[model samples]
Target: MITVRCFAQIREILGCDTRELLPAHTPQCAADLLKVIAGARTADLPKPLLVAINCEHASLTSPVKDGDEVAFFPPVSGG
Candidate 1:
């Protein structure tokens, strides 16, 4: 089971922090998974989401395996 975690804007819109036991198909990559969570709407995904897999920074194309932890969050900026 894949673990999906949403943060910040993504979390607020989805109204959840984590989703568990995702099927090991369809969305085989981090970006595709986020698109699925965003209801397949490109606009909903916005841009430049910070993603991590198994606690390490990863690209949108990173493959996800069963039991892998996938996390998503918007970019952060400080002045």
Candidate 2:
């Protein structure tokens, strides 16, 4: 299974903080996985969405597999 976590406003938009996807439902890369997770609400998500896989920063092209924890969140701005 792939563990997906949403944060900040994304959580509100998606109506959930966490989601679980079976390996059969997930794609090869993070980008495609995002699409599957976002579904028809892709445009509803914030821009420049950040991603982390297994607690480390990852790119959209990053390879993902079963048992990986994927997190999607908006950029953080702070002084």
Candidate 3:
């Protein structure tokens, strides 16, 4: 299973902070994981998402492997 985590506004939007997706769900990449979580809310995402795989920033195209930890959230900006 792939561990998928939601943060900040993303957690609020998705109504959960973390979840596990199975391969049978077709979460082969970060993008696929997003599809699994977003589902009907795909178009409702507040902003572009930032993805991290196993604690390293990665692109949505990054492949997901078993036991990998994936995180999704919005871009952060600061002064």
Show the colliding residue pairs in model 1.
Answer: none
Task: Show model 3 residue runs off by greater than 4 Å.
Answer: 25-27, 77-79
Positional deviation of 27 in candidate 3, in angstroms? 7.7
TM-score of every prediction relative to native: 0.79, 0.86, 0.87
TM-score attained by model 1: 0.79
lDDT of 2 by residue, 3-78 (tens): 9898897788888788898876535888777887788898999888888999999978888899999888899776
lDDT of 2 at 23: 73
lDDT of 1 by residue, 1-79 (tens): 7889988887887777998856655648887777767764547655787899999989889988888999988886669
**Cand. 3 Cα-lDDT:** 0.87
**What's the C-alpha lDDT at position 36 in model 1?**
64
Cα deviation at 23, candidate 2, in Å, is 1.2
Number of clashing residue pairs, candidate 3 = 0
Ranking the candidates on lDDT from highest down gives: 3, 2, 1
Using lDDT as the measure, the top candidate is 3
Q: Identify the superior model by lDDT, candidate 2 or candidate 3.
A: 3
Give the Cα lDDT of each candidate: 0.80, 0.85, 0.87
Clashing pairs in 3: none
**Candidate 3 C-alpha lDDT tens digits along 1-79:** 7899999888998898999877654448888889889899978887678999999999899999888999998997769
